[model samples]
Target: MIVDDEQPAIELLEKYVSMLPNLEVVATSYSAIEASEILKKESVDLLFLDIQMPLLTGLDFLKNSKNLPKVILTTAYREYAIEGYDLDIVDYLLKPISFERFFKAVQRYYQNSDRKNIISESVPERNHIYVNVNKKNHKVNFDSILYIESLKDYIRIHTSTKSLVVRMNIGSILQELPGSQFVRVHRSYIVSKNKITAYTSTDIEIGTIEIPIGQTYKEIVEDLCRS
Candidate 1:
């Protein structure tokens, strides 16, 4: 789904989406009202929305949707970023979007949906979780993290590119992370699938660093490896 008043923007986005595999443009609209009508009759997995539109803005359209699809906001204004994040959008893309950035945003949406399905299938008991560290609250990108390890009272978060230290219990941190991509491999350690490099019975290596695997968590680790 693509929505924009500007014909060129819609055309460019359509071209970009067409280049990707397994993605089809279900619909495109110049106004929110027209989009609403189309949405009423069809199901869309992704929406490329423009923020500034006459009558009903993209933000308003999203808020009014009964079943909202993953949205990527496209606009010339950068000020709407905070609002977009507040709405829990997949990504915020500025006007004249680069091919690389557009691809990354689409990739993020796919990854999020994939992990969500895995978690929903595996654990139906949990709803939401939170983790606090260094006096600053950090919401974990469940699919983006590789694992975590306890350092005294604090925990070190190892992602694909960087490691961050947060002051909190490992248990609390695990709750905030997405369960599909993360598992408690050891009492002190949590690892993300994308970050895992190597593993053995007693230890797991992420990149160049090795974390000890607790005796109790060995079975969990083995299960993950087999899966």
Candidate 2:
């Protein structure tokens, strides 16, 4: 079941649902009131719910409802994250949702679900990410990335083999990459922790290249060195 206020979001989730063989869309509602009414009749396994609605907000509805299924909160706002997690939501997805991120969220749902009928292919470790470059989605292995450099509106990802210029901000791309493997040492740079050869308080060395560590990141850099 998918409950969202916007028609486009519902359509997009429907498209994503169609891609998975095991997943099925039982119901879709534009408002929380309509969804509550549908829930009385339908036996839903999982719910993709939006945070904001007209009559009753998603959070308010969740608070008042009984015998609710496992929920995955879909919202554009980041402020309600802590409250959503407190309600024991399966996952919280920020919108303009990518298929990759959507797949991960579904995997989380399956992991948390008590149901035994699980899709084997739904859960798999991902080592690569697909990014749009020159109107084409290019698969770049996480291990191949040496460092990432910000170029105002665009970011140049420096890989071991080659560099790809992508039209994304530094902060947005950091969220996509694995946090454990990468560290942002400067405002304009994010370096792979595994790729570092040497480091001082002011700079980090990756083979022949030396990347300066910014003032704000000095403490974190020092901590990394200590660890």
Model 1 over residues 1-227: C-alpha lDDT tens digits? 99999999999999988877667999999999999899888889998999999999998988777787888899987656545655667777787887766765675577657544221211232333345555766655555576677786677876566667877666545434444566666667778765678888888888788878877668768777777
Q: List clashing residue pairs in candidate 1.
A: 146-191, 146-192, 147-190, 147-191, 147-192, 148-190
Worst 10 residues of 2 by lDDT: 116-125
TM-score of each: 0.53, 0.56
lDDT tens digits by residue: candidate 2, 1-227: 99999999999999999988899999999999999999999999889999988889999988999899899898997667546755767777789888878887787677556666466554445688888999999999999999999897788999999999998877567656665577778878889999999998789999988999988778768877787
Q: For model 2, give the RMSD to the true fold.
A: 8.6
What's each prediction's clash count? 6, 0
| Candidate 2 accuracy as lDDT | 0.84
